[model samples]
Target: MKKIFCFLLILSLSAFGFYPSVSSASEKSQQEVKEAKQYVQKHVPILKNEFKKLSRSSSLEDIESLIEKHFKEYPAPQSLKSNKISVFDAFPEKQHKYEKFSGKSLNLNNLLNDIKTSSTGDVFTFESKDNTVKVLLGEFGDINILEQKSISNPSVSKAKTTKATGIQRQTGIGYGTYGTKLYTLWCEGNFSYNGKTVKVISKDGDYHKHPSGSILTLDPRGLGKERDASIGKYKYKEVFSRLRVEGVLGFKWGEWIYKARTVETYIGSTVDGNIYGGLKSYK
Candidate 1:
């Protein structure tokens, strides 16, 4: 009888172990969804409030000034403790292997490949204020900055029409740090135009500084139809003679929206003063 009882007990325990754990999993999933919703509600409001203020900007400079004032949320992760850049920022390490150049154009595939070959899992530091970006590359990965372009009122045919409007254009910002891979920022009213609406599919870009000011990099591949329709000629612009970006502005002129995508790249400079380069898009 004792032997029989022992066997029965073993069988009961095994059955209990095999029972499904669906109830607990369901509860955990619900909790995660609730937390995510709360996060969206909290951060989305700030973007909305800032956009309302930007609507009042009258000139490209005014719009840029408005964004600069309200765009205080730095894109760098807290682990890196930098405002504009982080240490562990990685770009597409190795994919493209060609070199192309124009009077002022960027080759993204090669750029990403270089980043993959370089950059270790180390942190860096960066700071930007009043048109200057200062970065401290720490003890990992070789950094090469190359082909930087800076322009004050560097007007292009693409941005000329939009510049005439004197309204602030919304731009997204990305930065990197040690513990965090990348940080992203967006303005609420920065999107939505002329009764059209859209959302970001993905982003690929880097953060850098130029002779004139701070600049963010981007990639334009896989941007959807809404954004493709907004393409227009634009010139290089320095809103307050402080911030700088490289790409075609005024891409969103017609019924479409602009959505920018970015991937990781290396952490060095080929030429001094020219930190990084990539494509730019919006949607």
Candidate 2:
């Protein structure tokens, strides 16, 4: 009687489509795993070579072009169409920790090294620290990459000022937001009271977009008082001895999202010789 009841239960579940045939499902899963493993074994050498090429690049433009070529040749699989893949300008070191899809931290370089000796049926899964973004190596070696989306809107912060040799120096802090992610920008300008001229002495900044690297550029030219200037999509406004520099942050493909595509930053000098900065974004 017990055996009969078990058989009937199985039949009922199968009829309702609640219990797929265990053997068939298992076989399919095994096949997918096999394919995934084969894909990784076949592509690992090519990926290594690509990284080697990237490491040799000397300029940002060259790196960007190489990455574009790499993507064109090895596009993400269909399973990861909605996920962003983390591409780097150079290979990451073993010490960096990235988040896994399971909410655990993983060392990506270590995993890549392990792939050199990975045997059949071995699976690897990992994620970047950007808001739990994931990368998987199963079921056709799917790699799901998601951007860091934790930045707030742009804002400015005031910083200190100093004076030497009739020249005033000011440093400003600017915050840039992409989606919900935040990154920082810093700018320092030198002003000469005698000539009423402003010169951007030094500038540095970065953003929170994972894998997609951040770049900051500044124009070092001196401007007369009350003069306006433009560089690329950025603009500088000078009013009396006060100066305001504003412009949109530029990004390459695969580095930004569609909703908040344009990130902007502005750094200005107050009449009292203080520095103020802020950032903004738009589609």
Q: Which ten residues in a row have the lowest lDDT in candidate 2?
A: 5-14
Roughly what TM-score does model 2 have, to 2 decimal places? 0.26
Weakest 10 consecutive residues, lDDT, candidate 1? 1-10
Compared with the true structure, all predictions reach lDDT values of: 0.21, 0.25
Which runs of model 2 end up more than 4 angstroms from their true locations?
Answer: 1-33, 53-57, 82-283
lDDT of 2 by residue, 101-142 (tens): 222221222232354543211222222221111121211222
lDDT of 1 at 122: 18
TM-score of each: 0.21, 0.26
Clashes of each: 48, 7
Residue pairs clashing, model 2: 84-145, 150-180, 150-181, 151-180, 151-181, 151-182, 156-277
